[model samples]
Target chain A: MKYDCDACGPELGAYLLGESSDETRREVDAHLAACTACRDELERERALRTALGDLPTATCPGAVTARILAVVDAEYAATRRRNRRLRGVGLAGGLLAATLAAVLFLRPGAALRGASAEHYTPEQVATARHELIQTLTLTARVLDQAGRSTLVDVFNDQLPSAVEGSLRPLDDPTRGG
Target chain B: MTNETFHELLATHRDRVFTQALFSLRERRDAEDVTQEAFLRLWRQGDHLPADRVAPWLAHVTRNLCIDQTRRRSAARRHLGVADADAVDGLVAAAGGPDDPFAGLDLDDRQRRLLDALQTLPAETRTVMLMHYGDGTKLADIADAMGKSLAAVKVQVHRARQRLRLVLGTADGVSEQRGSA
Candidate 1:
């Protein structure tokens, strides 16, 4: 191994640390035998590594860790509160949606009577129609205010179509208004 | 991640993270700040991080935060027209606090020289040296954690060792001998 100091300098650290490959270690070993400078350099590196290992560990202050945990605890609490609020809102929305569905679908003479408009006078039909519209408007507003757009969408698109389908026979010209 | 798991991670890694930050930034306050920020980030992203990779992930984050703080300090120094000499003096002064790991320690002359030289190296090189030697982290693990190749990590550690030797006067005779040869 004709390794000069310049050529062997880089390998010495790895060689000292035993990070060098077996073949590289042999080459460095052979080089060190012939190279006094390289051996001294290796010794210096060994000393540095030993000093580094001796360097005291710096522990985080108890107060600092406490402060960090305090922040994390506060954050976790706030998140839990937020999740609770959202769950409450979701439950309220679900109940409101179910109530609306029952009012629209389950009331007698509401959806079961195919010709509901024909069964009542013009005034009765107008009053019933106004009430249905008011109920839908209120439900939509509540869902919208709750920031539950999916429920609002159900009210806006599907619920209206359902009401219209139930009253579809009312659109017949042969049936009096 | 559960709160209990996060707390366990903090308990396990806080010292290592704090030590790394202290070494890289050379300031207790900045190191604490970086350590807190790193942990906060870990907490926020804990669910997304794999359990096996937490150590490396935390190490990488702590190193990045330290680097960011170092750059900010350099920019502030440049803005204020503070010379590097004054900044070095500030670092020395900062290390005199009660919590300083080196304070009142019975370090030998060579160890003292090496410590001083460690501060002179670049942040990346210093970090590699400290991680490899101080933390007893394997070079291959450091390479994987730092997203660097094994060869690159070895080079950084080698360069740091060489720089420390030069700073400590151990390399002077060797250099002269080689020069004459």
Candidate 2:
């Protein structure tokens, strides 16, 4: 187990740093025992480590920390502002959809009752159908603008089923009379 | 991350990041700039990084920013036709000034020589030494943070020691003996 200076020289740093494995340490230890030069080099490495450890720690200046935090704060503020705007758009879309639902189903003599009552004319039925389509289109556009266009997919699926019977009189002009 | 949590992270790791940048760049202004930039990046990506990995992530980013700063400086020197002397010379010249981080420290002859010699090593080598010695980071962790193999990190450490010894004029006898053989 004769380790030459060339092989042992590189291990000395890892040895001094305590990063060498057990077998490598044993090998380096054997070389250091027989080799005075390698031992001296190891001592120098140890001294170098000591000197490095003794060097003063550098502190980050206050101004730098302040600048970093300020930038982060500004970014956070921007994100919050964007979120608030989107939320406002979402609220508007929700109100529009709710109103559309109430007008078609809740008003006295509304389209739902008028479909069975035989009191409304064909012109009135056509007008209600056109207004419903326009309101639905506008609500879809508003939701899409708010980046919640997926909600429009839900609206598309549910609204047509609920309103189809009320608007069925459009297919038979005489049914409205 | 919340503002308070981000501030906590800055308080915890600022000095280490700044110290590493100083070791790699050898200029207090550049180090400060790099540190600020590194923390800003951490603030942006903190959500994706695990709490355990935050320190290593910061170390990796700081090291990269320092290397980039060093290269830009070198390129500027080359473009200006200015001879790039050892980086330590600049520190030594500004040692007692207001902006020098090491201004008020009491460094002895050997320590001073070692500090100067350290700046002459490549940025990556110097970074490995600083992480291992200055911050007491493990070699395996250093390898992980730097995205390098453990063997490569060990080799850099060894090269740093050899170069420092050579610069300090303490390796002449053994080096000569080995050179002949």
Candidate 3:
């Protein structure tokens, strides 16, 4: 007979654990009597179990509970904060985009307005200038100090005395055409 | 249960839980943490179970948590530079007290080598063996805590013991096992 190790297997497991019943005990003993291999195997297993069982149980670090709970709480708080910040960021981004879109659409005139209102077509600009020179003599004046200096130097270097004198009328604050 | 009763329950089982984690994870800090967490879960789930179920429930939850820690430790050991992270290895390497059964022996190296081999076992098998040997929990209790069928737990334990036999080699002077006929 290919020796019946079936019952012996669990018996050995129980024997190692000291939980073997009398029936398992008797059966395994009977097998051991007839089988030297099984007998030595049983002895070996029993010794191994005893050795391991005799070893002291290792103690976990003293502060393990507090540390684990602390880590858990920190992780929980971090998750909540991340969710809140994500919500706030999402709300802010949506509001900003909507505001920019509203500005562009509601005030197409502002977005589409030309460079300046005084800008005119080439012929219209020339005609207006000619009319101004012939009649009321409209002139552009530099109000700031740097602009005034630049205008003064440019006029002195680039224009004749009579033309410069003609430009003097436009310096009055009340002058317009 | 009343708050006082619940607090009493926690105080009563705290040591058992702590000791179990300590032995299973082989790290004191981790055991204490697992105990706290297990008890906290017990408190949170207090309404779900009756008072009598508390200890067994605590054992179950704590065992699971320790198993998780064991799995994490092993996985961590598999990564870079953590060879001794396994609890068994840590115990053998730094566990030099006279209290250690393996500390003084004719075959000290062999004992340590056996422990190191046991350390490399899969977490589930190691946990079963630890509960079986270290905590002295019965196969039935270990089976219940491990959520395994009694027969399956039996087989698992046998395998663990057989491997232990092979490693320790007739621990304490019986003889090496003869191959099965």
Best by TM-score: 2
* Residue B27 in model 2: lDDT: 83
Q: Candidate 3, B100: how far from true, in Å?
A: 14
TM-score of chain B of 2: 0.77
The interface root-mean-square deviations, each candidate in sequence, come to 6.1, 6.5, 6.8
lDDT digits (tens) for residues B8-106 of candidate 2: 999999998998887677688999999999999999995887787777778788888988998898787677564344454466567863464465556
Over A54-112, each residue of candidate 1 has an lDDT whose tens digit, in order, gives: 77777688988998899888888877666655664685478578767766675534633
By DockQ, the candidates rank as 2, 1, 3
Q: What is the lDDT of residue A125 in candidate 2?
A: 76
Q: Model 2: clashing residue pairs?
A: none
lDDT of 1 by residue, B1-181 (tens): 6678889999999988887887677678998899999999999995998776777777788878888998898787787676775776687778883455454446665565666777898777777777777866777777888899977777777777667666767343323333232
lDDT of 2 by residue, A102-125 (tens): 667764345546366566777667
Better structure of 1 and 2 per lDDT: 2
Model 1's lDDT to the true fold? 0.71
lDDT of 3 by residue, B1-181 (tens): 3344555776566766775565456565566667878876775564777765666567778878988877777677787456545565667667673243322234445445555657666657866775666556677776775677888988887777666656655442324423322
Candidate 3 deviant stretches above 4 angstroms: A1-3, A15-25, A58-177, B1-16, B19-28, B47-60, B70-115, B169-181
Models sorted by TM-score, best on top: 2, 1, 3
